[model samples]
Target chain A: MKTQTSRRTLLKKGLGSAAAAIFLRAKTARSHNIKRYPNSCGVLVDMTRCIGCRSCEAACNAEQKLPSPALPFDDRSLFAQGRHGSKRRTDENHFTVINRYDPPEIDHPLFRKIQCNHCQEPACLSSCFVNAYTKTPEGAVIYNPDVCVGCRTCMIACPFYIPAFRYSSALHPQIVKCQFCYETRLKNNLLPACVEACPQEALLFGKREKLIKIARHRIRNDRDRYVDHIYGEYEAGGTSWLYLSSVEFDQVGFDTTIPHEPILNSVKNFLAMVPMVLTIWPPLFAGFHLLAARRARAEKTRQENNREKADEDV
Target chain B: MKMFNPENVHLPVSGSKKNDGSPWSFQDKVLLGLTPRQYLSQLCRNRVNWLLVLIFGVGIPLIVQRYFYGLAAVTHGSNDYPWGLFLGFGLFGMVPLSASGFLLGTTVTLFGRKDFHPIERLALLNGLLGYFFAVVYLLVDLGMPWRLAYPMFVSLGPAAVLFLVAWHVATYLSVQIAELLPALFEWLNRPAWKHYIAKISLGLTIAGIILSTLHQGALGALFTYAPTKIHPLWLSTDFQWIHFLCSAVFGGLSMVIISSFLISRYASWRCGKEFSSTLHDITLGLGKGASYAVFTYLVIKIVAIAHDNEWEYLLTAWGGYFLLEIAIGVVIPLILFARGVRRGSVTTVRWAAAIAVIGIIWNRLNVAIYCFNYQLYQEVPHWKEVWLTVTLYALYFIVYRFIVYRLPIVFTWNKQSRKP
Candidate 1:
């Protein structure tokens, strides 16, 4: 009876292990198709064309229905200081901001438009466990405040430092960022408010492929006027918003050192180890348990044999 | 306190019980076996109560002020540094220190190191409370603390590293609770539940290992999202997770050592002879593990720098700070651990463990706050932020003390069975 029970247990264990292995393989296969949207919409901002106008900023504020800024949109003194400090950022009150960079080499100041770059593979979307973020087909990275836990992880995960939290709100809070106007405008095939409001036509909205081509064309045609490279063509795995600047990208506050690969790629190394640990740890630990139990098992068997011998003798 | 000690010297099993043998009531237990009047007298006699009163007198109102007015009332309100001391110390620092659950679980259940069984329950309790309070810290820092569950059931961002961390940490918290159920069962005198947990112990342990591996690595991976912002010396695309995991091994083990020492010193009344006797040996064994982990961590740190070819940054001021962190946090504690292990000095090992714990905190803080946005100006945490962090940690301490006082963590159960 004991032998029969042991045999049954061994068979069960064998079947369970086989089933787990099969499940693991199937899960790995399914994970490959989980890439972000490939044909998402994008924007290209040519810094050479920007004349330090804050019109885009005002348009974003009005479109989002955010509270009006302390400084009026016509106040050019905000640029003369050339430093917005903590005020110059995407916040609960503002989804985008334009910062002026005065480089020693350039005669005129350069204006850099700051907003969510909306990477082809967004870290914010991936980092959200509740799935509050989505990358639409139009390439606009959007967020749902309803599902937001206000964990502020998107703020941490954003490679472009775009997502801002409303920390002061004790009752209701949400992350603020440029969503490319996905709900109100982009979904209806209308351009984002900021892109439409640019009087100088500094911002171009279209398919990411076309935007890249357009940005490259402008740079190639006016090499002396524009920088040799198109920013965000590959940065952080190809952001939707491309940039062409007269000065170097870094000089205009662009983080040029960001890798071409998506930020998610860096985390993949660890994620790959998750399934391995889950699969390997059980059997490996169980084997150790069996080994550790060996001595105790042998001792129990010896005691049983002695008791049986004594009973026979009596 | 007369009820705490029986005048009669007989009945060894009921050494501290009254002659007419009855279990102490919950209220009586709280009073430490003293009468109501005596309990009040004892409370009044202790000078520590006055200090606690003074602290609460000032601190509680400040905490209330935070809730009524908003975070801006207390914090510097700098958007440039969204995360302050609450996250830097409470989240990043506390989580790694709390890795003791997975470490001890892997030790006894996975590696079959039953020799270290005496203090296993304490280590598990330490882990559970650390994580529980880490979440509490997270809640206090979150803008919408009430909507904390929105990310789990409502929204699903499977692609994000933070999403993975949230899911895994939540799942792992449940796993750790389940892993700890055996101790709870033992305390509750429910042997059947203990048996049930033991049956599925292997599965629970494997789950713990998997979740811990991902989340600990994910915390480091979270920083990888800000490649240009974080200091180049700390950011290694290929080895960031490994660096985190390796350091956490030492961090968790060292935490266990420190906790064990504190319990042994302050709560000897609560500890059993077996725990007290075996704790020193376990400390040595844990120190050995910490040494091995720190040695590997040092190697990985070197390899990460080399792999990134960030040797040129070594001449910069940030590089000097990195070196300082390594020297003070890693190298010094490692030397202390080695010497303590060789000499069989429990005191030395205990102090080394404390230093190692601090070192781990320093390392995590460096990654999360100090060296982050290297090109940007340094962000000093707001004074209110600092106070709030301290208050939250003090609450963690209180909870820890409460559990340790009541649970069978430090003390052994069923001592009568061992009697010949």
Candidate 2:
């Protein structure tokens, strides 16, 4: 057999290019880990408590000093507005938006707030080639606009599609998304604008560990009312922003099929092979050249010997 | 090895010269041995020149406006779909088709296939331009075009798939340029420069393979980051990069056939006797290679589906689209190529090559645009975006012609002959 298939060598000889590339990938990125923050604070959101109030959205806009939204904060009419078959996602103008999901036989619609999930292992942080994203000690995923080249790769990498670009600007384009109010609140151990503005007490602020217990306790206490699970406990490797809801996650526009592991885990295998290819492919191809050249030389010598014999006879 | 020369072309291997045995001036070289008046007349006579003028009139302004007014001026400013035709068609679509350089490089230099020497330089040039212009397309799409070095020199996200793509493409572009250095030296008639390149050709060829292997696969690996966003059929974590790399082999080879077909048809003046004589054989060989690659790609695609156990997905409308893609790009081309190779039918092979190129482009577009966020509503790119994409492509064509017109690509330089 031209190719060897012994077990020790597959891992020892390397799965060749793929395994080595993944193995040597991101040697410098060990410092920027998404799992470093265990005691970092997080916000647990209870969907059952929300009343579709526009107060939190208004507070977020005011706190960020963002431009007024196209529709007034008090307007519930925007719930019917959708373009290109999708509802209003967060954009450069707004960091967070709530979508109303009407459950059948229920008198009122369930208002689900959509914002950056602030994943433990964030897709945005991993995908940004410029290292523009920073997963802070306080569990908020912050972005540095100055370094952002605005490739918009973060948008595609994001499972929740949270990162939005300022494509309207020609001179300077920046990615706009929620930072969990890192600068104004989370860093200083204060409540974020949206959390403080929640009149229904739907937003709870605590350590991520405590938030998990709170989520479980709530689900266990209300067996029939709650869906016995925390939405962000493991989705995309556990987002800092956890969710509790009465309805199925899909019905409320949540992407639950996303692998429980971090998005980076999906590509880790390929990255491991990069180093192997860099080291192995060069020598492998060059050795092919050496072998072919040797054969050509041997053939040349044989032909020359035959020609010499004919000349001697003549 | 014998040098390539197409006898059907205008102007012989020798440059236009004075009767006293002096070579033509720089101006004459630029004119491809034609006089100033003759060159102007030739430009005016060609229909392609007129089309170029029309494209420049519309395209240049949009390109300028894109920088002046921002991407929103020339594209449908959709924040949801950050990448449009510029990246989908230009970077992704063009890069794979340009893979011929390394493929041919490894075959000729590494494997010692001397018979394939005649078309190696052309493949190298094609690869160089494809990669160079892919970067050009990237610059146009980047929000901060000036900070392109950020991935390399500035804040580094070495862990990211894009980081690998950026480094590999940048290095590969340089490697491709080095691989074509001998041809450039030959065109300049500097034998010493050509000899210097010959010394390091093996290294350059090896670098080309490693870089091309990674970056081409890295393009697909870029999608692996978005597991939930892209359609499942298009996204295979285990084999996504392999699928891309395998498909690229044929994508690159088929492109050479298509480009050669165009050259044989339209720019016959540039080819020499060797090129003309060898073009048919080379096309057939490339077709055979493409058939094998397409078959391999089809198998791996099925394996990916099986590994993921996504058979039920085939029952959906998306499955029908996937089947259609395979039928057109893989099955039809595979059948035509196998028959064409056996019967020595260059026409069938040519048709198969064209189909394969289209199939590759369609696949890239499907990944980058159509099936991305399949659950979300579809996006029809702004008309301006389409025009801008066409404009960049036209520019690529113009540069290609300009180089082919002067370079020792399809023809070898001959010292014995004097005067054009």
Candidate 3:
């Protein structure tokens, strides 16, 4: 039994060393690649130029072929009561909704269109377990309904609350969100319907890098007309949709306080610990068990030896 | 039922019957020593049954209404507050409370603490039921509950934190069931099955530890995806997972302590002498462990706040609420647990455990629902949503009571010891 136990320990040690070597090699290879998406397409929304016409909303609805709203797109009353002190948001039926925010100091109400910001490193994409969501090089955060399990974790995980579930359906429920016109417009390298329909030319479409240059140029060229900072330039590790506002971005319905780093980076701290615990805990705990068992074995042996001595004396 | 010799019939006091040489039927096993009439009488006599029946009566219809009419039918249908009580109470509240199984398993099996062995099965049972019901709550809340297997067999989201949570929870649930199988085998007079399970016990325990660690931390990591939304006081990029994991250690232990107290007080008939006698000692031991965990949690929480330099937020109302959660959930429970352990006062410890359990639930709810998007107006859950949450919890209670009444969780099956 002792020989067998020793042999097993030796084998485990050999396997452990081999695994360590392989893991180290893999870590080095992973560090070497460090890939980043460079040529992604993006949109820049200039809030100063947008009129609360709801034209973008109408265009998005028509383009997506979504169900008609209970209120007509022309109904201005819908903008009277905004959502949670912001503006209207994306839902299962509506991929994009324009919201009106009236700043106390400003004479005119500002319109900010809400949809999937199409984040460069989207939380929804990272939070999906089934690989259901994809951030295409065309700069659209698209979802595959076929793989979604209705876990709603993505809904919980999304900072913008962009992903909406078709909860009413009993048989074939799926997540509904804006795909940035990936199928009809983005695939053909054409501007999204929302951008095309905006009569004020409030929305601009181009490569993300080029869009950043245009946004900066607008801000630098006419300093008083636009906010100094681009809304999506650093928020949540930048997004495909950039925003330039006349008033403070927060005043115009943008979440200005979101961290610059990708949200997944926060979670990775915990994830990195998982494999370490799995590898280290078993052997460590098992070793403790062996040590405890050894003491029991030694005690039993001593008792047996003493009993034999006592029997001989008798 | 077939008369195994009285000496060989290793049944609890209520489990035995005067068998007249026939195989025991499922009904006979369920009835145990009670006559069919007596069992029926007991079932009808319980007041809890009427409450459950009423909940199902009302809630089932509402659930159906939800499906037919849409989330708008049963809920206020606020797009702003997408998640309501179903998630707040069920998923967030239950998962932490269920942490007892892995914690206790580590103590008894890995650490060789034989004194805790008597109550180990109860802890396992508590963990299993909590997780099972959490999933049940998930089903009720999910738009397409039937497609739950999509993440596993159909779609793969390897990058998602929730993906890890779903896979790990499913895997851990299986692991927990496997861990509890030995008790079931023992009760069924299957010594061979018991031996086989015992042989693989170490492997299962390690797996439970690993799976529990990831999923429990994953639950917290799920919140990391909403970094800006969750209040900074509760949100810690570096310490969020650790905070969740540490809290669960005590949260699970406290749940076991609370459950044991309830069993000893209300259902003593179901528990054998071995369980009842050793329970108080185990409770104290568990309290000691809980105190240590709570202390660590408190320190890490402070470190998290300090790390982020969020000291100024303490002056705000949100900060006050955060401090209140810490005070009630961490400080008060820690003090109570410590005092109870020092005084060897089982009653005091039990009360502390109950408080800790409630405190843990409150903290989780605060993180998931209340403190979430703190800058925005607070979302009050819809009436139907609240009702649905209560209905699910009632179901959990019924299942727990049913299992405790029959399973050899608190009591050992006498037949196994009688054998060679």
Error of 2 at A231 (Å): 0.9
RMSD after Cα superposition, model 3: 6.2
Error of 3 at B361 (Å): 0.3
Candidate 1: true interface contacts recovered? 0.62
TM-score, one value per model = 0.88, 0.93, 0.90
How many Å off is the CA of B4 in candidate 2? Answer: 23
Candidate maximizing lDDT? 2
TM-score of 2: 0.93
Give the distance in Å from residue B367's predicted Cα in candidate 1 to where it truly belongs. Answer: 0.8
Give candidate 1 regions above 4 Å deviation.
Answer: A1-40, A80-87, A295-314, B1-20, B47-49, B110-112, B182-193, B414-420
lDDT, residue A122, model 1: 82
Higher-TM-score candidate of 2 and 3: 2
Q: Which 10 consecutive residues of model 2 chain A have the lowest summed lDDT?
A: A27-36
Task: Rank candidates by DockQ, best first.
Answer: 2, 3, 1
- Flag regions of model 2 displaced more than 4 Å: A1-36, B1-20
**Residue by residue across B75-113, what tens digits does model 3's lDDT show?**
765555667777778987899899999888888887778
lDDT of 1 by residue, A56-107 (tens): 9999999999899889998888765422243266677878888888889989
> Scored by Cα lDDT, where does model 3 land?
0.82
User: Weakest 10 consecutive residues, lDDT, candidate 2 chain B?
Assistant: B1-10
Candidates 2 and 3 compared: the better one by lDDT is 2
